[model samples]
Target: MITFEGASKHYPDGTVAVADLDLTVETGATTVFVGPSGSGKTTSLRMINRMVEPTGGTIRIDGEDIRRQDPAVLRRSIGYVIQQAGLFPHRTVLDNIATVPLLLGWRRAKARARAAELMELVGLEPAQARRYPHQLSGGQQQRVGVARALAADPPILLMDEPFSAVDPVVRTTLQDELLRLQQELHKTIVFVTHDIDEAVRLGDRIAVFRPGGVLAQYAAPERLLAEPADAFVESFIGYDRGVRRLSFFPARDLSPHEDTVFDDQTRAEDARDIAEGHGSPWVLVVSAERIPLGWVGTDQLSRVPAGVPLGDLDLAPYGHTFNIGTDSLRAALDAAVLSPAGRAVGVDEDGRVVGVVSQDDLGTAIWSVTE
Candidate 1:
């Protein structure tokens, strides 16, 4: 556990980064520091590892004053991941992950073996182990950085906007991966981010800071959302706090529209049963494997020439699919909006169609839980 007692950072240039902060980062939980620019989230994070020395007060790790220890030794004991990965350009992925292990005097073979294990743990291909940092994608490089941080098996980790550099899709993937890893490893992590949504998604406890490094509120994500300490925090969390909170609720209770689904192989006469349904005139199309292809309108299906194969006709756009059991309500809503038919297709673990959820149905599901 880390404890801060009136910790403050006053730069020589008369800048105040952190101001008399007092907080405790509990063991085995993620503590996120989030705010807009000049909030000193990064400065607070660096104080833990002694990267940025505090000009006043004290910071302790596991009951020992960090200032009492050598900054170099203290940093080596803690794992840190920052934006853009900060990997050595010339080092192979394996060697980059193995750096700290080798520094601690582990045998070269053992360190490399540890590196190989972490690479797979972070979901990297073994084939990429031989590639340089430049050869990997931005997401891949971030993975390598995470592996390197975990290489020493530190109990605490510090992340400063680590996922902010990647595109939204990859950033979400990385966020999910971190949550998955935290479940298994249970590291005491300190994360920094400007995005309230990212903080709500990954943080067990969030610290909302004001512009002067003043800690405004520190609480669990749910509490922070349900009750903001002041207008500043409310403004920072955005007007969509209620909508964002839906992500915490399970989507399992949602009842999908099973009858609206029609196999692409269904004959025009067989599809006549769907035309009388009160829902949208469009129906989902699926392959023989049960994978979603797109959408098809009942009017078009009704006009199909008798004896013509349904598979030979064109299909409208289907947008995207979200797993019923795994995805959040936000994802369901997103899928519904993207779909040309104003519905979302629910898929199984193997990507086969399970059913569909309409926009109205999804909104009702969200209201049921939120209300």
Candidate 2:
């Protein structure tokens, strides 16, 4: 919903902060401007809301040029969030969040109602509304800043390193929260940051600016990670992109076998018969109550009376021992890969074996990264 055409910023001292920027941000997509300090990412974001007026070219919101509208009116339509929250220290959290709506002449009660709802929206409790910004944690203050920017239901948002001031854990939580909000609200956003990883994680499209305020590469995160536009872009993404690619790998790719499983109560003689019938050498052993007991070898049976119990043998498969519900792709792949029998068992929240994750399953999952 935002477009920059031949946009450049000069301070009248012959120093150009940005030059000849030409980019289009699609409606409702989170477009990130990522580069090092003095690379013009923040400058570009400010130019959108008329916070920094372009010296050379025009910025258009939707289709109309932003210069045509009053700066205050344009800013009111587009939410602005910055580092350190920019909250008014003397005001209560709810009062701070209601600032923008109040500026827009919203009724005091309605603006406050919206502010209270926003507090809950950002995972803050209602009690926090009455407290001052200084009383809240750093993360909480940032959320209040977000709520303040969003108080008026703006169609667009300009975020200038909004999450950068917080701790790493809180930054992650805010990023995830913003992503969830985007899934629902779909507001057009232009976010600027120096952190490339954050750009890749949160952006639908990333515009990487180089040293001279030049656009290096702009593409989706997957394409940018798999194939960068140049050596500089590649180096910027770093070698850990292979690790980051795991986010796209789903549980479907790591499919578990749904075949019948054997428990400890299963006799080795019967297991041998089942294995031979299926043309396999071993079977998954389970308890008498239908819980996983591990795998039993067909040839390892000694002697057993008709209904006599079979004692627990050595756990042959590493997959049989590991839990699965919350396991990462790497851990699940490792269990099957490191197994002597080349198979991993996937257990449910309970200890019972739900399915088997075999070498084929692991290979198939890895192959998905390419295809």
Give the runs in model 2 whose Cα sits over 4 Å from its true position. Answer: 12-15, 258-354, 358-360, 368-371
Q: What residue pairs clash in candidate 1, if any at all?
A: none
lDDT of 1 by residue, 134-182 (tens): 8989999999999999999999999999999999999999999999999
lDDT of 2 by residue, 1-371 (tens): 78899999988777778988999999999999998888888999999988888899878888899999999988898899999899999999999999989999999999999999898887889988899988988898899988888889998988999999899999999999999988988999889999988998899999999877789998988788777899888888888776565554544446676453666665656656666676555567666655666565555653444453344556464343446667656566666666665677777667767777766767778777656
Going through the candidates in the order shown, the clash numbers are: 0, 6
Off by over 4 Å in 1: 12-14, 88-96, 107-113, 123-141, 165-173, 222-226, 239-242, 265-270, 273-280, 285-289, 298-314
* Colliding residue pairs in candidate 2: 262-285, 262-286, 263-285, 263-286, 264-286, 319-345
Give TM-scores for every candidate, taking all chains together and pairing residue i with residue i. 0.83, 0.81
Winning model by TM-score = 1
lDDT of 2 at 154: 93
lDDT of 2: 0.80
Q: In order, what is each prediction's RMSD in angstroms?
A: 3.4, 4.4
List per-prediction Cα lDDT, in the order shown: 0.90, 0.80
lDDT of 2 at 226: 76
